[model samples]
Target: MSDVGRDIRLVGRDLPVGAAAESYRALVSELKAAADVLGAVITSHKVAVVRAADDLIDSLDPVAVECGEVNALRREGTFLRGFARDPMSVGRVVDEIWPRGEHVVCLGAGGSAIALGRHLLSRPEPPSLVFADRSAAAAAHLESVLASRTGVRSDGSGSVEAASAVVHVGPGPWDELVAGSPPGTLVVNATGLGKDRPGSPLSAEADFPRDAVLWELNYRGDLALLRQAERQGVERHDGWQLFCHGWAAALGPILDLPDEAATARRFAELAAPLRPRTGGQ
Candidate 1:
């Protein structure tokens, strides 16, 4: 299993959803022996488990079903494949901005950082992208990996690869990063700081460029980032829509749904009533 920082595999008491404290290796063996391993459902924090599964597979391969910081995993035939579902939401959310900015910066080089950066970096005529984290190593690892994906080959240390000339990766203290952003910039809070715990990634002294779009990935929480964005009077969005798209996209491959406009629209319509309100008010 892979994680950005700490590895808190499971949280709280097992409750009724109990499972053994088996090693990832043992779990993979069990999964392989099961009657027709359909697919695996994964949450972000459990990503390392999937990576372990990928390593254990021999007969078939592990494919990445959903792409983002964390991916949904499944087995095919003797192949390990990785799929990113987050891009479906990422693209949609960015499109709503009508005209996109010349730059896109993602704060926090966690799982979502890799997934989001990949999507943004791969687009034709992509905007200049920056991913900054408190840990230089973490930020570099992300940058190196992302850059290498451009057929550039990264050293896994997040060094800036020359092949991917458009991106700028760096360390955190994002206030300066935010302050220098161009107007209409697209800024994302992928840190999971405010959502899971509390506090904003940016300091109160940070400046948001005019007409920028602020996207808070956690729909519900004590969101300090969203409040700051709102205070700055920028166009703001919560992750509710993105969350819907993520599930739909992840399930698409599993349920064999068509990747059509109608399908996406239908998914959104169905999910709308179920999505809780996430305004900072």
Candidate 2:
């Protein structure tokens, strides 16, 4: 907001994942009732919030509908609107680093993973996806969503060429999966472990794929996964770019700002100084 010269006050609301529908409904009702409140940018509870308060929202953008999540909320003259800007935000960061035809292994089957899958499948030549989550339900949900969008199937075959697959992993220690990825694959830690929770998706013993790009989707926190990537001498990306792009995409609708690359770049430049410093910064 400071980048756009808007004097908006940002507030933080930390809601646990899978909170009851009433909790989200109350929050949405409060926001709608508050005339001074502009809107909000959701983080971990994107999908949960949307599921809980679907009927309360006056409108939802196409992406929100498709992804079953809402990362941005806006109020428009007595109407409450929801938008899932993660695809746009994730696309910007992925396009810069992702090599065409390289496999993608996302460690979480949450909102960000779904967004990444959706963006990748939209490409003319979609890269094969491997989504792993501790929760069978979450992995199945991601598979179902992707299957509806593209005719991809998950048959436990683990065939990157024929179909994408969702693997239900145990808690921690994904050494075999991480080490077995093809060279130059894009390995992502979409699980909120490093940020929202403590710890990393991969154990310290895990070895990253050769020439792979490791993307840890957390700008701040312990960020053990990022440190592991660095220790292994692989090219790594943090979530700072995604964070900036997400805010820019959300604020574009809330503040009526221009949606263009230049604007997003300027926003990133302005936000750079405020980014949290991790180890060896």
Candidate 3:
């Protein structure tokens, strides 16, 4: 493989966000001046890292600024740059699957919610968005954030509330959200219920749209949502592709690549060696 085309090593450390607040000084102190380290990929302190990397020649991903996940980091000349690319991954994956004329109902208004909302609005013929979260305020905040990004007021001429295209839904009515959406609507499971913990977002009696497309943002572990979608014969997808492109996009700029696709292609070729030798069953 060429120098730029080779797969860059991805090292990870899982630190709790709460602890990051208390230990940030010591943490960064330890991480500083580690020459072999391209950067540190910190999941828990996503927003904190982005803010810290803002000054000087270092770069931070705009998506990471919006949502708080899948950040790519690299240090250059004493500055650490952080980038979040999950939104791009969502765009690429959704484009290949549903493309146009698909209203999207994203379950959970967290980082993925922000990613989905922004991408849906940017499409040539943007799909309508509905953010459903256990917290009503989070859903509302997502709508407001997307409105600002889309260049409209919360209730402006083309804003979510004005046209009724995008709605922020609270808990206990998830089934209603699903039933109300158009058939073939894109339903995203951005919540950590199934992966980070046990259980599915939708209740046992919840029903999906007639031909909905379900995108569960978890590759493994308890996959109640994926199984539910499959049982209903829905077009379902997992997080593997999202994971690949997200990392590719996040690290693209750091690696001096022009675009996410190139990074992804190179990584795919390199990862081929790790699949078969990968054990566990």
Candidate 4:
């Protein structure tokens, strides 16, 4: 269990329904009997404790939010981590797309989007990031918060000259929002649609440059959109790498893991219970 970051194991019941409680309890009970077990992190990705069994698990252990339920679980001492509903891991991928940028357009005002936006602003000379959503009120709130911190206007409407990256929150249609864009634009998908499903962050209507990098944030397995990008002559990035990026980003506060090359290798070798077997066969 002490395989660097691999020491962190994600455990959960097979289904997103009721019976998982007893199953989870059994798993915990078994782990407690082990020698080097440190702590457990219950993931709240699909829903928050509505499953009768998950509620039971929540009653017994600490939980981690997948989409951004930090405020909801703040009193519970749950730490914040980004989980992209989209196939690509947006925060980590965006960091790769633009290590430093003038501006970033973030579609969707969910938890992961806000978390990444905040992380960006925390960087020394952070990029000007914008939060956009169908809910005008949601976007307005995020915009106000960012404007106060970074002093850049977050009107959610402007030119790429004013922004460098455009991240779509979910698999929702974002091409309409970015129809008018300059070339060499950096587009990112922050939604969870492509994680275990098929869909692009942007729509087929808009013309995303072939040279553009079409990154999906899901970081699970092979995504349908990856093939689409390949056919379109666009470069595609695997989603799992983003998870590695995220783990590295969160190493300091979450696990305090070292960042040396060997440390990374050791961390990758560790088995993570967080990953699930997709398409239940």
Candidate 5:
């Protein structure tokens, strides 16, 4: 393939109120004008916009691949931290609920949630995946794309088959879905309300069945759900683990590198410049 036409691109789509679509819409021209745009992945912090851009890019069928097949690699704040955790524990959860217990629910629509949903789609039996976001239209669009390759639904309920499933839960700064899960259920919290921000999906004091595992995708203290889970005597997973787990998956394709392990090595080398600059993490 010729390198001349190989470039990563982002398209702007209309957004819901409070989202920064206008700003991103303006950047499209500037991004397209820049040199060395090829091989670079376009990213957006907003989940809906990312999905829109992803749809646009897929329509163009660019040669460049997405990072972990995700349009953006967000930091471990609220949404990303949530996505990072699913892959970390999903395998173990799948093993526990194997053959029949292969349903996974993501509580939001963001880079992290998309990454986890994609990861689960690659597994054996391909756990039924669902995308429960406040934006019903965005959830439908993303769910459609996810189900295109895997036999899944995002509606959360219906057709319990060996496919991914999605559910659109409107206006949730709530956790009714996660709290209602049965034992050994794999529930991932992919929202940003309880990160450095206050207000968790469900009450920190809510009683989660012993068989269910609650993991929050935040890395810092004073605002992390991990701490809240601890205080509530709930078993929780950490955000950094999600970061590490998803990193291998996301970086590989974005970097045009080999397998997850090789991509990790290359990224470690690239990050060497930051070790002394940031004093290493």
Candidate 6:
């Protein structure tokens, strides 16, 4: 808001991970009914909210439809608009760090993983993507989502030629995936463990790939994974840039901002002081 010179207040809402569809519907209805609520940024409930309140949203951007998630909401008169801004935001952060055709290991196969995979696979030279999740369902869902969007299928085995694959890390360690990745791989923690939950995706014993770029998608928290990266002398990036770019992307339509990049830069400058001085920095 400071970047745009608008007086806007952000309120945080906490919802359980597997909340019922009706609960999300009620929340969406409340936002629509509230006159003062200009817009909202959905966090962990991106997919759940969209699935539960698809009828309540008047418009969904193409990305939202494709990704089956909604991360931003805007109310226009009687209509509430939904958008999936993760792709745009995650793309901004990834592009700054990723070179084409490198390997990428995303720890959590959730909404953010879908967005990141979608963006990366769409590139002319798609990188080898390996998505890992504790839940087999989540990993399968990510594979289906990516296949639907990119028309590229993963052949169960994570062959380089497949370009995309999912691994179920149930009752096992994430260390193997990280250790097996080729040098210069981009390892990402898309899991909400550090912030919304506790602990790191990779255990302390995990060995990071040589010349790996570690990306922890949480700017504030215990950030155990980030600390581990720093300890190993890996190049690291936190989610601060993604957070700024995501808000700028969402606010573009809500507040009708003229330049999203400028707004994001301004937001970063303003929020820099408040950012946690963690290992990634």
How many pairs collide in each candidate, listed in order? 22, 0, 0, 14, 19, 0
Among all windows of 10 consecutive residues in model 5, the one with the lowest summed lDDT is 75-84
Off by over 4 Å in 4: 5-10, 13-37, 42-93, 122-147, 152-172, 209-211, 248-256, 260-265, 269-281
| Tens-digit lDDT string for candidate 4 (228-263) | 556666655554554554444333233545653344
- Cα RMSDs, all models: 8.7, 4.0, 5.0, 8.6, 9.5, 3.8
Ranking by lDDT: 6, 2, 3, 1, 5, 4
> Which TM-score value belongs to model 3?
0.79
TM-score, model 1 to reference: 0.72
Q: Which ranking of candidates, highest TM-score first?
A: 6, 2, 3, 1, 5, 4
**Model 1, 2-58: lDDT tens per residue?**
121223232222211123325555655654565555444344543445445545644
TM-score of each: 0.72, 0.90, 0.79, 0.55, 0.60, 0.91
Error of 3 at 208 (Å): 0.8
Global local distance difference test of model 4: 0.45
lDDT of candidate model 6 versus the reference:
0.84
Model 6 Cα lDDT, one tens digit per residue, 48-92:
887789999999999899888898899987689998888888888
lDDT of each: 0.60, 0.81, 0.66, 0.45, 0.47, 0.84
lDDT leader: 6
Regions of model 6 farther than 4 Å from truth: 149-162
Model 2 accuracy (lDDT, Cα):
0.81
Judged by TM-score relative to the true structure, which candidate is superior, 4 or 6? 6
